[model samples]
Target: MRALAAAALAGVLVAALPATAALAADPKPDIAVTSAADKANYAEGETFTITVTVKNKSSVDAKRVHYTGGDSEGVDDVVYGELSTGFDLAAGATKTVQLTGKTNHVAWQRGYGYVAFELAADNGEANDADNITSVRLMVAGAFDDLGGYVFQGESYDAGWTPQTPGVEGVKVVATSADGKTKYAEATTDARGLFRLAQLPAGEVLLTFTAPAGWKILAGENGEYDHTPALVIADDSDEPQIYVPAKKVPVSSPSASPSASPSASSVAPSASPSAGPGLPVTGDNTMLFAVAGAVAVAAGIALALVARRRRVHLQA
Candidate 1:
């Protein structure tokens, strides 16, 4: 009776193992970022700091988690901060991250910039909507932008023809008229649009740097008083010199026949000639053996002669 009772208890425990594992396999961690600015107002180009509070609201621990946030316009655009570098957060726990940023030179007439951020985790989440947050700051004054679009162009004897496709990743820079001081710089995006804000009031030179394998047809370098009005049109903008794409040369097949002869074309002669004009018949094994020996001797002699020539050349 004792052995039978022990077996029944063991069977019950075994049956419960699957349920326990199924419960353990289900992971739910909700990550969220509660963002706030350190101050309400910042002067144009004044550096400021913000805090982002990261929270895991679920009962389960969140693992391999990270957070992403930056200035409203772009990362480090008006504000910058250190993002979470993948960490584990205990159940219902929260961690705060800090970021530093400079207020943009160009802002609304009333002066306002936004800081945005989001949170994520490797473990599945219960809800994703609450993971993002943003904060606004008042920045005084407005600034001009050095911005424009770059396009593809084709060159002809008369002039250049502009195309609709925009060139991306062109480095645009704003500098003083003498090319000494650099005010702001930015790279063109997919739409070939670039903007450099925080530009001081003065004459500036705009230089465009093309990516690898691409040439700056026009607007390589130019002077501007105000934000120069540049369009894809030639008359409206500077002369855009476009070089056509190079043509690939085609190869033609050679006229010579194949160097190697086919096996079917190679065949044994009908009569076996043992010597010059000497055809042998059956039972010529001895004759063939003698001929093979002579041929081997001639080969050894030729090899020795070649070796001797090599030695002489070395000497």
Candidate 2:
């Protein structure tokens, strides 16, 4: 009877040991989506790859594993790809599956969006049988194109020095002709190159700000000052700004011989007399004396002519 009890005990212990071992084994699915062949961002009509990795966590080998692309959470009506064939993933083993897809959607707003993925067993499409791992894909648009312009003079030249080299800053502001609407703005780097972007095609007022210890010199017209104005058209080329050197005071040249003497310096001297001993007559008296002399000479000539004529007639 004791022997029978021992055999029965041995059988019960063996059954309990198998049950304990099964309970200790891991139960979670080992499948994972490793990485997307293409990074988050994609251009239109670009082909990209999505890789799904499957690992069997259970003691029993998974005969077949399958995956499917699902709706992107935040993206509206975004499509992924046709699900691939089911492949065998052995126990405690991993396999990477590749899926090809194209981006048909475009014009995403200027923010973050994600692409999602769903995985499952080949036999069932329900959530209970499906081991789902989502790979988050970000979608973004391209950066805006900044138009080009030039810089010159002390701020840009090699010989020029700034009072506070590193601390000083310069920027270009573009606005409408009325200066009411701001279109674009760019800050100058140490090299003094500022690129303006996202500007509409029109007459843009390009203004510059001088760094510390520097000033912006305005040209004859306010538009083209130390910094020239840029008229950007749809087809216009990049603007070239020629900032002239600071105006240094130039000394005036000496007066020429032809130039009249300054009125402030010397008084006018009296003219010399026509006769050596007589003082020079005033302009009015000189005119009257000349007229009297001319009259007396004319009368004497007339008398002499008449006397000669009478003598001839008497003879």
- The predictions' CA RMSDs to the true structure, in order, are 27.0, 22.8
Please tell me which predicted candidate would have the highest lDDT against the true structure. 1
Global lDDT scores for all candidate models: 0.62, 0.52
Q: Write model 1 residue lDDT over 126-235, tens digit each, in one string.
A: 78799888877765444455456665544311132334566688787777667788778887777666766666433456677767655554432322212222111112
Q: Mind sharing the TM-score for model 2?
A: 0.31
**How would you encode candidate 2's per-residue C-alpha lDDT over 114-173 as one tens digit per residue?**
455666555332224436555544344433323432333443332333332322256668
lDDT of 1 at 151: 54
lDDT score at residue 89, model 1, on the 0-100 scale: 84
Score every model by TM-score.
Answer: 0.36, 0.31
Instruction: Count clashes in each candidate, considering only residues at least 3 apart in sequence or on different chains.
Output: 1, 1
Candidate 2 differs from the real structure by a C-alpha RMSD in angstroms, to one decimal, of 22.8
Q: What stretches of model 1 exceed 4 Å from their correct place?
A: 1-25, 68-71, 74-82, 108-110, 142-315
